[model samples]
Target: MSVTGKYGGPLPKGPWAERLHEIFDRLLAAFGPQHWWPGETPFEVCVGAILTQNTNWANVSRAIKNLKEAGLLNPEALFSIPRHVLAEIIRPAGYYNVKSERILTFVAFLMQEFSGDLDAAFSLGLWDLRSRLLSLKGIGPETADSILLYAGGYPIFVVDAYTARILERHGLVGDDVSYDSIQSLFMDNLPSDPALFNEFHALLVALGKGHCRKGRPRCETCPLAGIHLNP
Candidate 1:
């Protein structure tokens, strides 16, 4: 409801901002707080973001727990292991081999660039850090933004299938909407607070899983059920 964010910039007063704010309010009222990212440390959060590429959080949690039990959750310890062994360690997350390579590449990048100091790497400007992360072989936009926002505490919006699905179902976005478009819709229109972005994204995920499910959305019972976006 505030016209400006604590960190970002002045928000334009328009239909998009109002509608997005209303949606965020409704979701927060329905779901309260989601306490998302589900990791104790920034490194763990980054690892979860990568491992969660094609799997659920449950699977990711198992894989992370395995790493923690093995005392290899940090970048250096994880980077030290053989790829096959790393793959075996994260077997529960599905795509173990590919994810292992990705994790190694990320860790390698971290080690080589910052001596495994994530704080140092995150100290760069938003776009600079984003560009560096996107240049990695396995890190895509969503994954990169997840690390930036959730791990680095940057004010960036993260888009996922749940986000796109809910927006499209509510007539806020068209079918086949792009990741960047959805991301820009929120970033451009909303107050650029990491806490708001973080909670809003998490709440959308909750709605997607609980009501606006793919191929079987229970729209009648959804929190955004009666409110239509005036596009």
Candidate 2:
């Protein structure tokens, strides 16, 4: 897509910025804070980000609850547990064996790089920490950004299928664009604020689930119904 610019930085007042603002405002008006990433701690958020790969939140929640009940929710404890046992505990999240290894990988990275302190891992400036996360075995762009934004409160926007569907439907971004390209639409136009990114992403997920669905979109009732549609 022809979205990326030469400077690749936040733009001045323009259509792009205004459109993003309009979307955020309308979505917020329709739905309040989503209280997303329902985790008790940053470590739990990180675990959720990893466990949520290809699964719904309901299943991920069950898996996490199992971990907590077993007293293996912390990184240090999870790291010491047997791989197969960890896999069994998180079986509810699906892809148990693989997710088990991935969670262990992330915990080990934390233990080694930051001595099991999520704050230290989060304190590594956005790009640095994101790069480290993307290097892990199963962590991809969406997963890494979820860890960064939802867990560490980083200022980077997390792009997912829902965000992509909304932007494409509104003609803000073309269909099947690269993740970074779609992400630039917000990160390059909106002010760099973690709170804004967090709530905006959550709002998009809400819209995607409630109205702008994958199979059949209810555009007429969508919060962003007529904002950016080229009529």
Candidate 3:
């Protein structure tokens, strides 16, 4: 599963770093800065990260709007609300019943650990915070990393399907790479800055949505079309 090359020689870290930065530059030039994790508060961003799983941002927005309109976006309110009621409110997000449980599970963790204070929760060390987040019922690596980088302002890189597709297409990673391996490619190469990680991930999403489609990628006009492949 290594991305070094077919011959198993160690990949030169310097070139990989430079190429990663080049990809980032190209994406930035094409899409400009993308202020990501679109939410009003840190808590809201965490909620959006949870709700956005297996769904579109538009649906997550509607779900968040419903919560806000119903005065239930607060951790206390969400923690105290009935799961059925919550599910009905967030029905537009798809998998309402499951997502409701997931949100409430996170709310419970927030209340129990940090007394519902997001800043307090984020104040913990990165590994400690991420481990605790992963211990939650439905929060996986991507969701936990999203919460960490976007909501907690941590410097962890968040990898998604778009990121894997882009790297694989550019011969930077194996198609069967694990999540941790894909994530390590960025974390090992890029500077550990929250802003850079945020912008890079968002730009990848933009490219994924706009050009690097699943079935038929618009590679002819993609911003990274002419970029040198790692392999």
Candidate 4:
């Protein structure tokens, strides 16, 4: 099952799409389906995407809970709340001041451009919506893609640190590759289905958390242990 041998042969010449599908299949077989994007609504998913920047999901969950308790989860309520108040409420998420501003800015954008309707906002074509989202102050590619895939149901692959680590280690991509390039490796290869993209990204995250961790990985028990790197 190794991708390379002691002789250090050349990398597999198979289509990257097929290889990626194989990896996906292996991951799916190992982890089952991951019902990701732990949110009750599209708006909540978008909020979580923002708050999750540079933080863990537990903190994001606590912050979202705070908003829910205050009945401020909707666009109008979030927009009307004072920035300082919002920051205080989400203080547990870390960098609360900046995150509060980013959230408020996103809410304002939604209200002004889409009349506070998430469906309308997401209805734009994929590239168009992604461009609009990336134009916002704090939202970057990962965040934008997360919103597109998980919240808006767009067929776009979301690449993150975990994805980069796995691909680089497996010799599928260089460490210096751009996010778009890495993402295209999945998007251009896999079927353009939001559900597939969602599950694939979740499975990658799960692998990263459990096996392909930072520094020395616990490769022996990794489901991907059979994979060998290119010479």
- Could you say which candidate leads in lDDT? 1
Number of clashing pairs per prediction, in order? 0, 0, 0, 1
Model 3 poorest 10 in a row by lDDT: 1-10
Off by over 4 Å in 1: 1-9
Stretches of candidate 4 exceeding 4 Å from the true structure: 1-14, 228-231
Error of 4 at 123 (Å): 1.4
Q: List candidate 3 segments past 4 Å from native.
A: 1-13
Judged by lDDT relative to the true structure, which candidate is superior, 3 or 4?
A: 3
lDDT of 4 by residue, 49-128 (tens): 99999998999999999999999999989989999999999998999999999999999999999889999998899999
Clash-forming residue pairs, model 3: none
Cα displacement (angstroms), candidate 2, residue 116, comes to: 1.0
lDDT of candidate 3 over 1-231, digit per residue (tens): 112211122233688777876787788888888889899999999999999999999999999999999998889999989999999999999999999999999999999988999999988999999999999999999999999999999989999999999888878888999999988888887777787888889999999999999999998999998878674
Model 3 quality (TM-score): 0.93
Which order, best to worst by lDDT?
Answer: 1, 3, 4, 2
TM-scores for every predicted model: 0.95, 0.92, 0.93, 0.92
Ten contiguous residues with the weakest lDDT in model 1: 1-10
User: Which candidate comes out best when scored by TM-score?
Assistant: 1
Model 3, residue 171: distance off in Å is 1.4
Whole-model lDDT, model 3: 0.89
lDDT of 2 by residue, 1-231 (tens): 111221233545777777777777788878977787799999999999999999899999999999999999888898799999999999999999999999999999999988899998888999999999999999999999999998998889999999888878777677869999989878878877777788889989899999998899998788787675432
lDDT of 1 by residue, 48-143 (tens): 999999889999999999999999988889778999999999999999999999999999999999999999999999999999999999999999
